[model samples]
Target: MNSRTKSINELILTAKRDGRSVKYVSDGYHTFDELYYHRMILFSVICHANKDRAWKSWLHDDGTIFNDTFIVGIQTDEGQYTYHYKTEYWDMFQVQEVPRAPKYDGHKPKDITRLLTL
Candidate 1:
């Protein structure tokens, strides 16, 4: 496994436990802190491309897995809005609460499609 990927994963675990957020906005991946910002973007793209639009992370070596996903973007005929994507791919992801079916009350014919948790 790539050490960079491993370090990034560890940082995410720590952040979730502390209930705090990180902000590392450099392209350099030499340090654990530097991986925060880039990890968010990379994971979003990966999740968005996946068939199920979710990422499975084995947080510990014990083999337990957690599903992670997020809303990456929204689009309508008016414009497109890309999410800032602040969460990590493997952090406390995927809401545990049961989801309710959506209600599209007054959307026009050119309504936006679903903004999936990718």
Candidate 2:
């Protein structure tokens, strides 16, 4: 609906298409609608991952929905991304972009920045 939600939806969709599980945990929600929306998103992702795709059976089951201060790391071909969403009233969230680091073979040295400094 909103820009933030649209971005989140895009991220979730990308993750789903790539056959990756999205880690979504919220500290708290201001309104019931917010909570419900989050839950539905989570459910959709989980269902997409499931083979049967029948997650409604467990909807009424006992379980904890949200956790406080849970950190999630997402790994993609581009790089690793760490997402954190703290307790905010409005539709606000933080996405920390981390560029992919160069790989090292260990035999030959790569990224001579440290060597250059010395």
Best by lDDT: 1
lDDT of 1 by residue, 1-118 (tens): 7999898778777987898665542346454466645555554555455424342322312432234433333233443332223335434334222132122234443433433322
lDDT of 1 at 70: 31
Best by TM-score: 1
Clashes of 1: 0
**lDDT scores for all predictions?**
0.41, 0.36
Write one digit per residue (lDDT tens) for candidate 2, span 16-57: 899876554333534444665575455334324432312121
Residue 25, candidate 1: Cα error in Å is: 6.1
* Candidate 2 Cα errors over 4 Å, as ranges: 23-118
- Model 2 RMSD in Å is 19.5
lDDT minimum window of 10 residues, candidate 2: 53-62
